[model samples]
Target: MTAPASSSTTPINKQVGFINAFIAATLMGFVGFFARHIDAQGDFIAFSRMMCGGILFFAIIAYKGRLLELKEFKLSPTMVLSGFFMGNCLSAYITATQHTSIANAVFFIYIGPIISTLLAVIFLKESMKLATWFALLAVFIGMMMISGLMSIDSSGLSFGMQFSEKTFFGDMMALYSGVGYGLFLFFGRFRTEVPGDVRAFWNFVFALAGITLLFVFTKPTISQMTSTDWMWWVGIGIVCGFGALGTCTIATRHLKAAEFACVSYWECVVASLFVGLMIYGEPLSSAQMIGGAMIIVGGMSEVLISILGKSFKRPDNVTLKAGSI
Candidate 1:
């Protein structure tokens, strides 16, 4: 009798991927907070970050003559339009953070996964098993538990002095921002006929160029921006270039969609840590630490449950039921 073939399982690899995704998300989470200090205005901030990131990417692609990758994709126009929409969506998010508390913005913004995932199921006909649906719920609840922020901006300062001060307008902005960004993300996932690498690069480039034209019309002179401001803009650009574009693309290769979404709460937790350590240097609040721990446990539990369910089920048996997503 032939020896049984060995199964390949890599928990360590998966965990590494999770860490990568967490870092990416955490870096991205700071965008809203950073935008608060960008004096160029939110729309301009969006445009600048894209333009700077695009320029950096374009230079690299051009130096290596990666234009062929772009030329291979005939749907560059539609993809770029999608990117333009995404850039605007990002602008709206920065504005939302300004208008509302970070907690409200971050929390409401995530509701997009719910919206976009449903849209995907409805329009793209993507389906999940019952277990997956439960997993989704678990992941969502875990995220909410992780981001629990009842206190008003850690410090008891007045609304104007703090960034996370609760506001109705900010809440609305964050909600809409999440919905729009969600549409951008979940909608694009279905249209995978186009190369993701090409779309990611060119879409941002086109969006930057388009937004730049608009900026020119609105306020041509940017003389007010100092060298430090440019440095910040470049930093933001690098944040998008590597954090959003490079690292996320790499992580997606190793992560499933559901897993990626579920693991992303780590970003919020990391953001909280960054705030605690770098900006504030204040001790971690008990509520926050507990909340973060719960979120992680919940997300991991659901993922483990799904994996175990699949593992334990007979190969021929149907492991999942309908209405899962």
Candidate 2:
């Protein structure tokens, strides 16, 4: 008896997805600010985030009387895999932040969009529009500029930079994080039958398990952590963990893998601006400023083109489920 979602509503849903993804990226940007304040190791920070977020999600589901949904939910391999990837991604990103400059870590982690785009094209069989390619190129070039790989000065534009031996490990970890994040996006595109909250809950659970295992091996001392450290952890857990992840899950339900990945580059721009200007008191170079603008423009252009370029066609494999905020 219920009417099917019309083509008109499809664009609106996609817009909503873009907005939620943008918000998630914004919340994620503040993660470094909280992580730096905590004296804990990356493993412990990640573990705490997952634990707290999982608990918060559980509480919300219970409050909404949606516990029945979990009871009826069947576990899927894709969901488990996605959750594990998310755990690894968070852990590696946090570790990278501790070892390398925020700019470098962010640059490496943002390679996720590229990875996701490729996987979506190959596996999801999603068509890549010319606009998407242009947006991706712009974003990649912007990231290069921001990472100091490409720079413009009074002399001219230069390419390449010296690598630091000290940050090599962290750089690798960030690259791994990007791969994990890409996989997370890819897998998240499947298992559409699961409600967003239920998926997020399991995501937290598996991520917590994975990080806990890592924590057991690393065994970083936590005795030095002050009350302030605990407070920051709780704040991050609530904001970036619960808030950001929840919105991101909702976004996955609405956007295609490649589309979500492209819009998610906003995270890098937000992170770079926040870490560079606010926390580090570092002045933004002309190149960095221009790079950030390009990223913003690229992301926005992708969203607009997706909405306006063609009629919405639902994928056969993916069910466009409506998610409650």
Candidate 3:
């Protein structure tokens, strides 16, 4: 028999992993700050983040002697297509950040989980529990509240319903990004042959190539930004590149799928909080605070329900099950 994680001092190690994830999320929150500083070069900033982050990702993998892992794949069109979709997701996400507040951007993109779950139910015949449905409903309501779409003031400028043309376009792009993200996850799950990390690495590589070509095609000049902006770009590389990816890999190692998903809710909150306090210094509206709380509560509720079901938990969470890539 093996030792329990709690008894083996691994919990402390896991706590360290959680801390990494928090820092990663927080640094990601600063994207808006960096974006605002670009001065007529928001598109370049968005493109460069992914390209630079992808380079950092590969560089780390090379240092770790995992470049040979890339040889295992024969490079099928399907994988390439999936990777292109993944690239689009990342590119669209960065683009969305330029158009809207990070709080709104992150919150809006999380519609992925809902879309992913529904897709699983329809395509994979996976049924969510009743509690999960409640969780979904709660998340939907929270999204509306956060987006300023749920209500309005008499002057047509309420907290939640303050939709302008730009806001609508931004939100729509974010929704598309979420769909690409959902499809990316679904496709990632489809690759039974590839290891998850290997798959992740290739996705990054594919994204680097695809987005770089697109970036060049767009003809963005990087000469306009300052040294400080480049430094922020580097921060985006380190924080989001290795930090988010590493924390996610480590967290998933010791966590249930529900646990992983539960902790992920923190990404949006941390992003939003950092935006509200650090970037804008705008106080959180009552609706936003309440909505944020609701989203967390809902995500946690679904996760806990999964845990309680034991047998009902996702295969990723089960100790003896064949793992997914």
| lDDT-based ranking | 2, 1, 3
Off by over 4 Å in 2: 1-12, 100-104, 164-168, 278-280, 313-325
Off by over 4 Å in 3: 1-28, 39-43, 73-78, 96-108, 151-175, 245-265, 278-280, 312-325
**Model 3 over residues 1-325: C-alpha lDDT tens digits?**
1111222212222343345434544555555655555553444554555565567656766776767756854566545655666567666776776676655666556666556556555665555667767777776666556544554355643443334676776767677778876665444433334444455566666656666776765566777667887877666656665455434434433433233344455555655666755567866666767767876798667555655665434333222212222
What lDDT score is found at residue 273 in candidate 2? 84
lDDT tens per residue, model 2, 96-210: 8778766677667778778877887787676888888988888788877766667897888887644599989888888898899888877777765566788789899998888
TM-score-wise, the better of 2 and 3 is: 2
Off by over 4 Å in 1: 1-20, 32-37, 76-78, 129-131, 142-169, 209-223, 249-257, 298-325
Per-residue C-alpha lDDT of model 1 across residues 255-296, encoded as one tens digit per residue: 445555666666666666675456767556555666567556
Give the total clashing residue pairs for model 1.
3
Clashing pairs in 2: none
lDDT of each structure?
Answer: 0.57, 0.78, 0.55
Which residue pairs clash within candidate 3?
A: 148-160, 148-161, 149-160
TM-scores for every predicted model: 0.71, 0.87, 0.71
- Highest TM-score scorer: 2
